[model samples]
Target: MKSLKLDYLKSLKWADYLFFALVEPRRLSGKIADAASKPLGGGIAIALCAVFSDILAASLLAVNTRFFYYKITYGFLLLSIIAFVKVLVTAGLIDMLCQFMGYPGAVRTMIVLILYSLFPQMFLLPLAYVFKVISFAPPFFYVLFSIALFVWSALIVITGISETHSVPFSKASLMFIFPYAFITLTGFLASLLALASVFGYFASI
Candidate 1:
């Protein structure tokens, strides 16, 4: 047990550990790119699915309230479950991407990326709750979080594309936003179109 603990400490010092922690989305994107022959639609679908799933999971968990009301668990259970679902979906998405992109060891990479990316958002949740500022908190927080993940993912993909893909991090970050921007725009347009169609149908009725 002592040796195991020592080894664990030693492993923490490795650069790969830091790399995986700081830039996990890149690793995830690599996996996704590898998995799908055509990544754009599949990537968007996977992301949207994960986001909706997380929202649903959080909503259901929030409704339980037993621990919050009686046991006085202080948000531990809620935060824990939220983190678990986030990590699960993140890992699954990464694995699917890697498989699509034709990368080797997609499953292993997904596990590593998920483990590394797990805790940051958990930390964010309590901070947000404590601050109690939804106006300044929710919208930009998730947008920036998604952007950061996508930036890392894009960096990994670009780096993998060429030995000399040496764009600055800021530029790469902007590029990463492209997919998300498109997704947002398209989603908005689709919603508008759907609303129009519904209103038109009602008018005819």
Candidate 2:
């Protein structure tokens, strides 16, 4: 049987291209130029990484909450499941945007790009939380981290979309807004429904 790592490497080596995803996103455009030909392993890797990232973040927050720090309330398993579902929903939302915009990209391509772009948030969350615990940090520190993470993720996605779709940067930015809003709304509604279900279950019990 062929290995997933070998499968991923068939498209692009993770060790090398991950740097491009970090410092030079434009480099990934050519690597995935033909989405149909690219190995699905890349997308799988991103999804798994994203799920584990969320779980790791949840674990760190679980410990930090006890220290009177970031108060996250989900257990690792729940958070991991939520992360998996979230990636699917967000990828679907991006596909919707692509359909509306008449962009000629596959849904798989969108999913891969979106998750790849979010790689930084996955890697940084634990470090940021640990750093804050090690030293007293002001609100500004978190604000800065949030902004940096947003810009970093946004730029990578925007760059990917622009280069892959041949869309102009300004238009790409506008195109991204719809999926972003959809993702945010989807998460919000999911949260409210979950809360309502919990309350209803409590009332029944």
Q: What TM-score do all the candidates reach, one by one?
A: 0.38, 0.66
Candidate 1 lDDT score relative to the true structure: 0.45
Candidate with maximal TM-score: 2
The CA lDDT of each predicted structure is 0.45, 0.65
Q: Summarize candidate 1's per-residue lDDT along 76-97 as a digit string, tens digits.
A: 4454456556545544554454
Return the number of clashes found in candidate 1: 17
User: What residue runs in model 2 are displaced by over 4 Å at the alpha carbon?
Assistant: 2-12, 35-39, 50-74, 125-130, 138-143, 183-205
Clashes of 2: 0
What would the per-residue lDDT of candidate 2 be over residues 65-111, giving only the tens digit for each residue? 45322223345446556655666666577567777778774666656
What's the alpha carbon RMSD for model 1? Answer: 10.1
